[model samples]
Target: MEKHILYTTEAVNQDGLNGQSFIKTGGLTVTVSNPLNNKPGTNPEQLLGLSLSTCMNATLQAIEREHGLAHTAEVRVTVTLIKEENFAFLVVARVRIPGVPLKTATKLVALAKKRCPVSKLLSGSSYYQVQVVEDY
Candidate 1:
């Protein structure tokens, strides 16, 4: 099988979680900080949550359009950092599609989980989960 790349972007972080991260193409930049600290910056957990939520919702929108339904799906992701023996993260993605039946919404979410790139990448991780919810 041949790989056909649709899009690609590079991000550079020089100071780990203490300073800043920026896109290589010079479009976006963000301050990186520890979530436990009072610093005014973004953390990895929040960034993971944003990535999953955005990717899942965007895939849901495309699926809804293909199914001839309104794009009313909403995705909320929660990422928790755990400190057991080492550092770990727990990710949960909840999706809700208004005006659609629970069963159908669940099916849509299942398809989205299978299709979304971020979801696919995290599917093998035991700490990752995706579920359909009537309310977030």
Candidate 2:
């Protein structure tokens, strides 16, 4: 049997970069914009960062659980927007697993990279960096 999963998020941007509507699959809506614009709400790039970061962390957590390791992980995702012709963006994911051995943390991050769908998706379209910033 083949399995398929589908997810969706709806967004509306109006007044140029002024106010944008964001609707999650759960029906949660909010206004989003660039903080540089001094406008209300969060920015789109940041939202992408948040999504990918959390997804990566979740994957890592699952890995820890699978290995029966008691692990608490901290993950940070950052998106950088480049201003140039055609423009571009970059994503940096930083992970910290305190109380876990460095070798183990490295292994888990490497595994998460393979398991994380978000990283795979972004890797094809943009720059993605993964770093194990801390391990005990």
Candidate 3:
């Protein structure tokens, strides 16, 4: 078995009607709460979507830099959580790689999907989901 690296995050929440938690990690803080609570904060679902898209984008950016390529990609990830019997979530990763060939862009996104750690954890292959899109 391979050794596992641990990551830590802390959230502080107070007991109240308008209670929300702030997760602190890596010198940054993310405030989260349920939408039903009506408090002003980012929800967990939104954060999850953001994390996945950001990870994929970062991975692709790394690949671009490695190849000394010009231009960059802008990524937007929308995650939908379906309330079903089991864990059901769908992620739509829309990416726009301007000035790059369609074939190259598609290939980079494919590699990102395969290598992104968050995408690995939340596999989209087992369900009816479109993981990546190449937006012109």
Best by lDDT: 1
For candidate 3, lDDT tens digit of each residue in 12-128?
656332445555543545556665577777766687778877887888888788778864877787767677888566667777777787888887778877788887876646642
Report the Cα lDDT for residue 55, model 3. 85
lDDT of 2: 0.80
For 23-104, candidate 2 gives per-residue lDDT tens digits of 5454655667766777678776878888888899999999999989776988898888887887677788999988888889
For model 3, the run of ten residues with the poorest summed lDDT: 127-136
Residue 82 displacement (Å), model 3: 2.6
Question: Which candidate should be chosen as best, given TM-score against the real structure?
Answer: 1
TM-score of each: 0.97, 0.83, 0.72
**lDDT, candidate 1, residue 42?**
97
Q: Which stretches of candidate 1 lie over 4 Å from their true place?
A: none
Looking at model 3, the pairs that clash are none
